[model samples]
Target: MANDFEVGVDVGVDPDAAWRLAGDPVAIRDWFGPVSDIAVDGDLRTVTMGNGAQLLERLVDRDDAARTYSYVVESGIPGLTSHRATIRVVEAPGGSRVLWRQTATSDVEGYDIEARLSGVMTAGLESLRDRLEGAAA
Candidate 1:
């Protein structure tokens, strides 16, 4: 856990539905403003976050039994270098819960900057929920 970036979203869709939408790379390019394409090669992936921010990371660990995937940043992004996000999906009272567990190391400045970056993940998750549940491109 290097830089912390966690956000939980409860979309109106079912858990399976949310997972389907979230795991689809094509659906990702649809809602994420900067993420042009998500190319996955083995455990490594390159996600182009808007504004020319290209993120390179690797799937170091995963618990298929738990339906959780953990990835670490290999390059790109600002501030902290190392990063990881483990998404957990569960059924909610009405729909589903998408919990994003992430972390990053603050560079030289401080953790406040890292905290702000957490908002970015939150916004992105919200965008995913809005776009998928609404089924609008």
Candidate 2:
């Protein structure tokens, strides 16, 4: 089965600031869940989670004009056949909104992969909002 979802977070920063922060994997490590270390080589990124889990991601598309970035997971997470994620920063009334979308296919027969992914996305977005807003304050 395939699962997809989007999590949006509004932060107290302009769209450009939000895009700048969201587009950098280094800044993502500061706010996105348990990411401990991030290393990038060209278009490939390796991320080490706080729990010592590691994942490889390939940058698929990035557009400054649209303020969007997309990537596909190459390996590391178990029980998933494939995973694709995208991040978009858009202007809002007061500040900006960061939208994270994830789509995945589970390798297992009956796993609640959607819920698991949703939890991670929610936590990451909340942390991102806090990080950006706190810095702006």
Which portions of model 1 miss their true places by more than 4 Å?
1-5, 25-27, 78-81
Clash count, one per candidate: 7, 0
| Residue-wise C-alpha lDDT for candidate 2, range 18-62, written one tens digit per residue | 888898756788888778999999999999989999999998889
Each prediction's RMSD to truth: 3.1, 1.5
How do the residues 13-95 of candidate 1 rate in per-residue lDDT, one tens digit apiece? 87777777665544567765667778888877888876667888787666544555677887886666566767777788778
- Model 1 score (lDDT): 0.70
Per-candidate TM-scores read 0.79, 0.92
Measured by TM-score, the strongest candidate is 2
Tell me the TM-score of model 1: 0.79
Candidate 1 residue-wise lDDT at 137: 34
